[model samples]
Target: MSVSGVREAAAIWARAKARRDRDPEPATVEATAPGIRRRLDLPGAKLLLAERGGRPVGFALVAPRARTLELFYLAVDPDAWGSGVGSRLLQDVEQHAREVGREVLELWVINDNERAIGVYERAGWVGTDEVERDPASGRLERRFLRHIG
Candidate 1:
């Protein structure tokens, strides 16, 4: 996915997140678009989309840092849950990190998203248990890390 694909990919992320978030007010496309565009413009930032029968079903956004690759966003369509889309997206992100020589992969998940946390944990992501409030939604989020390369 490229900068031209931001709007579609952002919609996939927003919709999937909305279905899974415990918070009453989920992120809206209007609010997430600008940040998605900014990230798309960043050097070393890559977006990967998963499609089923040519229809977009998931997306992952990885932002490369000095020593780590941040899995900035990963989401699958709610309808595609339990179909391995999330797992494949995460795996692809790790492969990308390895290709870039990143030592680790990092991502933040809302503290209340147990399903997502479980997915990451099963994939060997270890959480430091540190929590921070998201400025946009005031939701508590936890950071997870895993050595990748």
Candidate 2:
């Protein structure tokens, strides 16, 4: 992804997060650039962007772990929710994971995000009862995993 692409991704991320919380801080290019650069430089990192009508509508960033693909970030433009953008992005992630020899797909979702939780569950992801704090936002997060081969 290009720097501009990361900026777009950051905007989507911020919009999605803010929809779940009041007055959430926005993610700027400066805030997301370093991580984008770092991930692009990583050997096992996969970044996928979903576009419609030639405009980006969603993105997913996954990194390879020992036996799993960690979905570090996934976001769809708020206006595109419920339009299958999230599902297509996730399916792309799973395909990438399989191509890379990962056996499982894992991600953390903020506990109070019922919409996201429902989407994940409907996609066959199972909650693991593992809770953790998201350092950046101090939100409680639940772990979800799916065996993807």
Candidate 3:
């Protein structure tokens, strides 16, 4: 993904988070763009984008960690919710993990984000009892794993 693509993904992330969480004050692209770019710069990190009609609708970022792939981010534009864009991006994430020789994919999702948790569950991710407080948002997050081997 290029710089422009990072920006687009950032916008989608902000919008989706705001809508999903019903945040009165939503984060802007400026707050997220730099972080997305930084993740893309990480060694072995892969950015997967789902586009429709030649426009980006969703994106996922994954990086290799030991024998597993850590999913750093996954977001779909609010306008595209319920349209299978997130599911398609998730399938690509799994394919990328396999291409990189990883057998497991892991991610952390906010504990109260039921919609996202449902999506991950439907995609074969199993949640663990482990939980952590996200320092940035102070929200509890739970770990989920998918074994693709």
Candidate 4:
């Protein structure tokens, strides 16, 4: 990711977090850039950039966490929302998770985010009955996971 991409991600995250008015983990993506980069550089972590016919479009960053692969960020350009970019990115993530021996793939969906919740559930993700308060926002997020062989 370039410095500009990091800036863009931060801008996007700001809008998202502010829209939710969530509790508070570091709201700025740049604050987490170092750590994000660390994980992206890790052996089992994968960063996938979504492109349409060779044009960059979006990004998804995944990391192996113990027995599961964590979907860190799945960002799609606003202009590309209706396309299959997000779906394709997710499928690739699932495939990578399975190849790495992860029986489960996990992601945090912000509570009250009906759209994302619907998409994940329709994609076969189930809630884990766990609520985590983001250190940055203090709002609680429900954990969701999908099991894949």
After superposition, which runs of candidate 4 have C-alpha atoms over 4 Å from their true positions? Answer: 1-32, 41-43
Q: What is the TM-score of each candidate against the true structure?
A: 0.89, 0.89, 0.96, 0.76
Give the residue spans of candidate 3 off by over 4 A: none
Tens digits of per-residue lDDT for model 1 on 76-96? 878899899989988898899
Candidate 4 lDDT over 39-128, as tens digits, reads: 667667777777677655766788899888999877665556657776787888888887888989999977877766776787788988
RMSD of 1: 2.2
The lDDT values for all models are 0.84, 0.82, 0.91, 0.73
Please report, as a residue range, the 10-residue window in candidate 3 with the lowest summed lDDT. 20-29
Put the candidates in lDDT order, highest first.
3, 1, 2, 4
Q: Which ten residues in a row have the lowest lDDT in candidate 4?
A: 17-26
Ranking by TM-score: 3, 2, 1, 4
Give the count of colliding residue pairs in each prediction: 0, 0, 0, 10
Who wins the TM-score comparison?
Answer: 3
Clashes by residue pair, model 2: none
Model with the higher TM-score, candidate 1 or 3: 3
| Poorest stretch of ten by lDDT in candidate 1 | 21-30
What stretches of model 2 exceed 4 Å from their correct place? 35-41
lDDT of 2: 0.82
